[model samples]
Each structure stands twice: as structure tokens, then as C-alpha cells.
Target: MAIVSEALTVEELYYNYPDGTAALRGLSFKLMPGESVALAGPNGSGKSTLLLHLNGLLRPSRGRIAVGGKPLDAAHQAFARRYVGLVFQNPEDQLFMPTVGEDVAFGPQNLGLAGEKLRERVRSVLDQVGLEPARFLERQSFNLSIGEKKRVALAGVLAMEPEVLVLDEPSAGLDPRSRRRLIRLLKDLPQTQLVATHDLDLALEICSRTLIVEQGRLVAEGPSEQILSDRVLLETHGLELPLCLMGRPDR
Candidate 1:
């Protein structure tokens, strides 16, 4: 089989839950290296399902997914993990270690990194997330604020140094300041990113391309400004224009 050069690709992806609920319906998209794309949709629109598949957390009943040119399957699970990192919508689900540094060190530790190298890895990612290693390393996860916890969670995934970052509702529970900081941080990172978010503003600010999903299928795919400006199309898929862009026809 020929290798796909794209950073990520999905072909006719279909998935159904054990309870008979269809989560994804023929979803297909490709992300080139260093490209950032937004996967926007309403709740239960398969955005999370798609992110899970990118990192091999969930398997499709039908169809295929490739990460960094490698096909994802049971045999390539570890390879997929190394190539793709997924951050959950909820920080609590991803942050389990008692201290902030411990959580960030988990992935590299699993990969056999230890001693000073592991500490440096953890510190670098924490700094990248805007959490200074000096202060946050020893802090307990349960004691951190929601915004801080979210950053800690992100640091964990960033520490893995994946080629692709797949985030599910990254801005879901953040304050305006925290959210803006996150946007800036993500923009500075050079990895290929697929963000599944309802924050149209974030999508507009970060993603070059946007894909809208509704009822387990893609409804629209185009440039961010073009897709978000289509009021009728957004409304049909349970999305609204960003507040700043509202009342502006030229947007």
C-alpha cells in the first residue's frame, strides 16, 4: 500500500457505539502537515468521536484513519500515539497524577524517558503552556483552578511531542482571559492541529480551514471566514455567528 503523505487523513470513516448509536457517518477529511483545522458541530455531533479515533482511543466499525502517513490499527497503536496527541474536553479526565509535573511526565515516562531528561521534558512543556515549572511542578492537580488545570492537561499532551494535536472542546470551561491565552499558545505551536470546538471565535482566530458536522456527517467544509459567514448554513447545523462578527455582512 502506498503511504499517505498528509499529516492526517480519514476515508469514509463510520463508527457505531455498542448501544447501537451511530456516532460518525462517512466522515472524511485530510489535514496537511502544519495545517490547523477546526471541526465545529453541535453537541453529540461526533466531534469527540473523531478526535478519539485520531489517537487510537476509539476504533471505527468501518472506514479508515491515518496519522502522519501511518495507518492506525491495533498493530500501529503505539505509533499512532507517538504521532497524535488528544486533549479531552474535561481536564479532570486527563489529569490524574497528584502533582502537576507528575501528570505531564506520564507519557514520556511510559516511553522510557527518566531522570534529568524526563524532568526537563516536563518542565519544557509546562513552560510552553504558560505554567512556570518553578511554581506549578509541585502543585497538586486538585488544588489548581479550572484554567490552570486545563493548561496542565494540555501540557501533558504537549509533553508527548506528537506531530498532530487533536483537541476536543479545548475552550469549553475557560474564562475569557484563559481562553485568549490558550488561543495564543495554540497559534504559536507549529504542529498540525485539529480543534473540535463550538468557539467560533477561536476557530476564526486559529484555523485556516473549518469543517462543520451535524447528525454524524459533515455539513460544510471551507475557509474559516467563508464557512462562519454563512449564517443560514451555520444555523442549520446548530452554530451561530461569532459575536464580534455578528451584524457584519462583509464578514
Candidate 2:
């Protein structure tokens, strides 16, 4: 097979749980470098399941995934993990370290960074996510507000310096202000981002393209403006027009 030259590629991907539940079925797509795309689908559409497959967290029952042009398998799992940093839907799931600095530094530290290099990575990523390292570092990770925890969780992923960032339900539980902050932060990031979300507005705001998945299949893929504004197509797959698109003539 000719190698795919995209930042990320998924070809005819399929996955099944031990109980025989098929989470993904023949899904294929390509994500280019520095491109922001959204995986928009309703519950049980295999959005999270698909993200896990990207970095080899959950093995595919059948099919293939490649990161930075290399096939993802046990031999390349390490590279895939580092190349595609996944921020889970819940901030608590990713922030287990005692202090904010410790949690932020965890990934790079595992990769052998220490002392000033380690501290710098932690600080830079925190700042990258709009958190002030000096004031927030020594603070307890568990004590942070929901918004702060979300930013800290993202900082940890950014610290890995992944070529592609895959986030699941990034705006799931945020207040309007916090969600707005996250939207702005995500828009400014430079990595190839695949955000699996129910927030079509976020997709419409930050993504160039949108992939609509249903029953683990790629039902539709197109430019965000075209795909997201199509009220019929979105509703057909258990989604709605982006909030901003509502009340328009098309609606």
C-alpha cells in the first residue's frame, strides 16, 4: 500500500469490545498538519472510541491507523502516544499528580526531561493554556476549579509537544465563560487538532472541516461551513445546526 502522507490517517478502521460491540466500522479519514477538525456526533457514535484508536490506547479489532506517516502498532505505540496527545473528556481523569506543576511535568518527565528543562516544559505549557505557572504550579491539582482543572489537563497534553492533539468532549461541562476561554485557547494552538465534541458551535468556530460519524462510520465529511450549516444532514445523524447557524433562513 502506498503510504499516506498526512499528519494522521485512518483507513477502514474497525473496533469491537470484548462483549462483541462494534464501536467503529470501516471509518477512513485524513488529517493534515496544523489543520483543526471536529469529530461531531451524538452519544454512542464511537467518537471517543475512535480517538483511543488514533494513539493505540485501544487496539483495533481490525483496520489501521498511522501517525506522522508510520503505522500504529506495538512497536510504534510509544511514538504514536507522544505524537498524538489525548486529553480525556473529564479533567479529573488526567490530573492525578499532587500539584499542578507535577501533573503538567508528568509526560515529559517520563521522556527523561529533568531539572530546569522539566520545569520549563511545565511552565511553558501552562502559559500556553493561559495558566500562570508561578501562581498555579505549587497549588494542588485537586483544589482547582473546573475551568482551571481543564486548562491544567490540557497543559499536560501540550507539554508532550505532540504533532497532533486529540481531545474528547473538550467543552462538555464548562460554563459559558470557561467554554469561551477554551474555544479561544484551542483556536490559537498550532497542532493538528481533532476535537471530538457535541458542541457544534466550537466546531464551527475553530475547525476548518467537520466529520459526522454515526454508528462508527464516516457518514459525511466536508468543510465546516458547508457541513455544519446543513440542518437536514446534521439532524439525520442526531445532531443540530451550530447554535450560531440557528434562526437563519436555512433554519
Off by over 4 Å in 1: 1-4, 249-251
Once fitted onto the true fold, the runs of candidate 2 whose alpha carbons sit more than 4 angstroms away are 1-4
Instruction: List clashing residue pairs in candidate 1.
Output: none
The C-alpha lDDT values of all candidates are: 0.91, 0.91
lDDT of 2 by residue, 1-251 (tens): 96546999999999998999999999999998899999998899899999988888898888889999899988999899989999988899889999999998889999899999999889888877778888999999998988789888988998988999999988877788778878998898889999999999999999999999999999999999999999999999999998898999946
Lowest lDDT 10-residue stretch of candidate 1: 242-251
TM-score for predicted model 1 compared with the true structure: 0.94
* TM-scores for all predictions: 0.94, 0.93
RMSD of each: 2.1, 2.2
